[model samples]
Target: MCRWLVYAGSAIRPEELLYKVDHSLIDQSMHSKLGATTLNGDGFGMGWYDGPRPPGLFRGIGPAWGDRNLRELSEHLESPLFFAHIRASTGSPVQESNCHPFRYRDWLWMHNGEIHGFHQIKRELVLAIEPELFPHLEGSTDSELMFYLALSYGLRDDPIAGVARMVGHVERVAAAHDIRDPMQMTIATSDGEHVWVFRYSTQHQSRSLFYSRRIEALRELYPDNANFRRLSEQTRIIVSEPLGDLPGAWHEVPESACGLVDPGRDFLQDFHPEPV
Candidate 1:
């Protein structure tokens, strides 16, 4: 399992979400309160859109807190949309290529749970990826494979539909091998503007995911809170857990749900289970 966050809405430094909160993503890497593992020190990665040419990515096979390069880049880069991930490798090697927030063209993706029994279904999943996109495969983690699967299913054209189909494909294959809970995931994917996040599991239980309340609502809840004061109304975040403990600041995404966050609008709806 891993911990990750997607920040969008306001064009601000990625560090605002990666480091400013009391329990920032960097903090979670070392002291996560809700993850299966408190210390996600295997590796870390951050991706953010700047001007053009997809997004800038910085990854290291080091603890997030101890990575100076990550600190310098996060403090300097500003993007309306960004993704940060702290890894706790399940079965993959703890290398830079195995870090989260893998990218392809202008798209970026990250996941927080495992494809249950990945070792058993790895071959089938690999064979299912789009042959053209297969050449882009550069890592061995299940997370990276899942990204290619979504791309194969049409991520560039219809992310939601493509992901839904990818999960369905996984379900169909995993079931053939008698694997239960073929997936457990809280995934985020983006194309530099819109972000689609999903929280789902084959077993009806998934990792925690929460979205920040609208900035206005948060301001109302804590009128004097400096953090809320600094954020724009469009500022939104989807995380593996809340960054802070402010009341009325965060809401849990329901089990088997997908959250879509555009510039000024955000929506969360039920996610139908995918058959494997």
Candidate 2:
């Protein structure tokens, strides 16, 4: 599994989330305490949405903590919504193209889990992607392939439903190949407007995924904390783990669920897979 974070709300420097927190995304890349692995140095990538523009992406093929370019960019780039991920490869090669926050047009996606026995079902899954979208496939990692599968199933119109279909498709294909416990995922996907995250797996025990408590709530819980003062009411950070140990600053997203951090109120709802 990998580690990832999604920031939606005010336009702020990426470094605040990527480097300034207690267990910042960059810090997690090197010393993760709750991930499947402690070191997620295979690669890293970030994609952010700015006003009225297509998202911008920066990916590198090494430890995120040591990437000078990643650090430099994080310090200067600010956006209202962004995704940052540090990867730990399951079986894929460590190439830049295989980095998370994979892009297609205005959308950005990243995931922290894998499709069990991907090699066995890769051909069928790849062939299922829409013809127009399949040509855009650029890497061999199941993570990227999964993103395209969701898109193929209408992710641009509805995130949760599209993903449900994608997961359903994967499980059906895996079952046909007799692969048990066929998938595990904690995913984030966006089209520069709405950010949707899902935590699900065939085994019902997905992974560590959490969203921040409302800033208003955090302000009351930690009255003197300056970090809470700067955020807008809509500001929400969806991370793989808590960045700090603040008592009520973070809430674990329930297993087999989906979260949407929107421009208005956010939502946490049950997610169930459906046939594609």
Output the number of the lDDT-best candidate. Answer: 2
**How do the predictions measure up, each by TM-score?**
0.97, 0.98
The Cα RMSD in angstroms, rounded to one decimal, for candidate 2 relative to the true structure is 0.8
Residue-wise lDDT of candidate 2 within 1-276, one digit each (tens)? Answer: 799999998889999988998889988988899999999999999999887888999999889999999889988888989999999999999998999889999999999999999999999999999999988999989999999999999899888999999999999999999999988999999988888999999999898999998889989998898878988989999999889677778889999999888867689999999986
What does candidate 1's lDDT look like per residue over 1-276, in tens digits?
A: 799998887688888878888899989998999999999999999988877678988899989999888888888877878899999999799988999889999999999999889999899899999889999999999899999998988889998888888889988888899998788899999998789999998888899999988999988889878877887888888899899778788999998999789865678888885443
Among residues 3 or more apart in sequence or in different chains, the pairs in candidate 1 whose N, CA or C atoms overlap within 3 Å are 171-275, 171-276, 172-276
lDDT, residue 180, candidate 2: 99
**Model 2 clash pairs?**
none
